[model samples]
Target: MTLIHPAEDLGVLRFITAGSVDDGKSTLIGRLLYDSKAVLSDQLSALARAKHKRTAGEDIDLALLTDGLEAEREQGITIDVAYRYFATAKRKFIIADTPGHEQYTRNMVTGASTAHAAIILIDATRVSEVDGRTELLAQTKRHSAIVKLLALPHVIVAINKMDLVDYSEARFDAIRAAYLALAQRLGLQSVRFVPVSALKGDNIVTASERMPWYQDEPLLDVLESLPVGEVSGSAAELRFPVQLVARQDGSHADDFRGYMGRVEAGAISVGQALRVLPAGHRATVAEIIGPRGELAHAHAGQCVTVRLAEDVDISRGDILVAAEATVEPARKLSADLCWFDHEPLSSQRKYILKQTTANVFARVGSVDSVLDVGTLSHGQHKGTLEMNDIGAVQISLQKALVCDTYEQHPATGAFVLIDEATHHTVAAGMIRAFTA
Candidate 1:
């Protein structure tokens, strides 16, 4: 056996497990934790007490481990994104178990935005009436579309409930073929198919004896072997948003005056030059300090106080980027909107547009079209977007925002629209290239 070198090991693989309600998403996660011994004895005792059993025996209702919410337990469905952390000998994992219902698509988006991979479960036993057809669910397709849009590097299509289908290889093959076609059409780069029985523990933690015809790595094995994705810095240009002005405003004000924020992308070195966005001021990095102490360099995700060579009037929402790779500032942006509110959007009405750390007043200029997840087709212009609608929209911002296209840089490319009075987030949007 070849030993995996320490340098090659990816510390953790963040992934999301999503599918329609009652598709056994919670059970699968519980099974993974229980079968892999990730669950504690106390958790097992609690599961026993909950009495959410599929059968009458000592079989613990695995879903109870993730369905922690009282409402979820009562209704027998996941209403929000439930995150769980577990690890195996090979690699660590952060699992986001997102809700499957179409109404909660926004929750799924929130969970998957930072994920490196997506495990979309398909209910193999779910059959249609009339003639007994088992096509993929529309929700599954919708999740896939979102995952594709998020640009998750890895995709795993787990055909679940194989036991209910008598562990038929033909059924799994058919579903695999159909899903593969969908993946190709959606331009999903890397995709793999697996047959599993989340309830019976087939192809999850261990290889099942029932599916003898299949010979491949189990679901956990695939997850274990997948390479961790690169840091955001590698995916996009440098973008450092100033969250605060780190100043004592007292005796140490002169010594402690620095810009405090996260390195959203790329690295920062002591002597590197940076251009402050919106302010259009140039400065050189004089120092970088972290939580521990001083740092010569800082990379993406590291929150550090950056000292500049010159005192530039930088405020919250101002970005520090490489002078060579500066992005364009625009007030009008064409973007794809994921409307989460029950109230349909009105083009003439004013709303709050929050892009990055900046919040400005805005209004919808146009609703070009709505996308049909079922057919992967775009429909004619809809005047308003109802709840859980995905469409193309034009937004006019009160102030210009330095931004990039979602295809170019996700950090600056995505934003949310909020109601003026309620302050509730009504829509999430991604830049679709056109900006002015």
Candidate 2:
């Protein structure tokens, strides 16, 4: 088989998988990679050797392939977001396999933050057990809410381990119903459900004869058929956060100054009118330079330096946006946060908030409420947000930030919270619709 070149695979899809522990998140990914012919022969042989040494009655556990750490193998759980890459004739895919334990929910947030779609796994046989059913549903709801808050548009519910239930249609139907209810509550627009046995490799790559009663498309079929393109809202406005300022004084260039950064949203072209934030100065794009050479036009994903017609006071943390689509300056911000660190987030403690290339000193003004994933309700909380907990909080920034809605501009609306004393990232935040 020939390898796909980067330029040939222009369409790339980033996706993540989440579910309660032992829901087969890892096994499903391994099967997808294995059956899709993404794994190498050497890796396959290693896996075969490991499978040969398995316990007498236990089947070859595909999850073992992705469980990297000794602790993870011992516990049989994923603790960090394990990333895998694969490509096909149609598109290239980056899969983030995240942990399902409640304590590792923060890792889920980290993985889903950059994903365009999410795969939520559910075990068919455990859908009826009280503890099992409730936990699974709750985890699904939580994962869905976070993906939505980040403005992800697609979701695929993979009801795994169908073989354990004799590939029964009734079991698949019941689990599908429960998941549909949760998706509806969460306002998910693009959703698909598939019955799969990740361990047995049924309905994952090819249609399963064991489940002839089910007539829907297989999991891989659905993934390939889904519309894979740049999301719609991402093309709404033009916002570029200045990462660095380049200056040159040479024979070809005399006192040339440019702001270098990646376009956060929309498209930009030479001579496009730009409005600098905070300073509120208007200028025209004189030239757009990419790594290769000057470009006539640039889009959301490109990293390029922009030179303006006239020099304006611009600095790091400042945003240059289309004059017509510029947003209001914000001092106080409201955000949905996923606490990752072992230390609980405290409202009274100060932290640093990093937005794109801009790092600003900020403090948590108040802890609004913690979300109860199962009920989709909020509980009043004021003390601290523990690891893996999702909550809404208010933050007071030292300087005003120009930002659009998270749904409107994901790159600019997302931020990371760092502990002031330890200088460690403690949480990931999505800027919600701002409060007046």
Number of the top-ranking candidate, with TM-score as the measure: 1
Q: What TM-score goes with each of the models?
A: 0.94, 0.92
- Model 1: weakest 10-residue lDDT segment is 126-135
Task: For residues 1-436, write the lDDT of model 1, one tens digit per residue.
Answer: 2344676566789999988888899999999998888888898887887855554577789988888888888888888899998877677889999999988998998899889899999999773433454467889889998888777899998989999999999988888877887888889878988899998899999998999988998999999999875465632378888889977755765666799998877888888888898768888999999999999988877899999989889998998888776476788989888888888898877899887787789989888998788788877567889887888888888888888888777877888999998888998888887565
**Candidate 2, residue 286: how far the Cα is off, in Å:** 1.1
**How many backbone clashes are present in model 1?**
0
For model 1, the stretches where C-alpha displacement exceeds 4 angstroms are 1-8, 127-134, 232-236, 249-255
Instruction: Tell me how candidate 2 scores on lDDT.
Output: 0.81
lDDT of each: 0.85, 0.81
lDDT of 2 by residue, 1-436 (tens): 4466766555778889988888899999988988899888787666666633232443445676677777877777899889998877667789999998888887888898888788989888666556555334567677778877777778998999888899988888778877777777778778888999998899999999999987898887776666666542332378888999998874565689999999877888898888888678998999999999999988877899999998799998888878786377788888888888898887678899998888888898777898877687777575568887788988898887787668667888899999999999999998986643
The RMSD (Cα, Å) of candidate 1 is 2.7
Top lDDT prediction, candidate number: 1
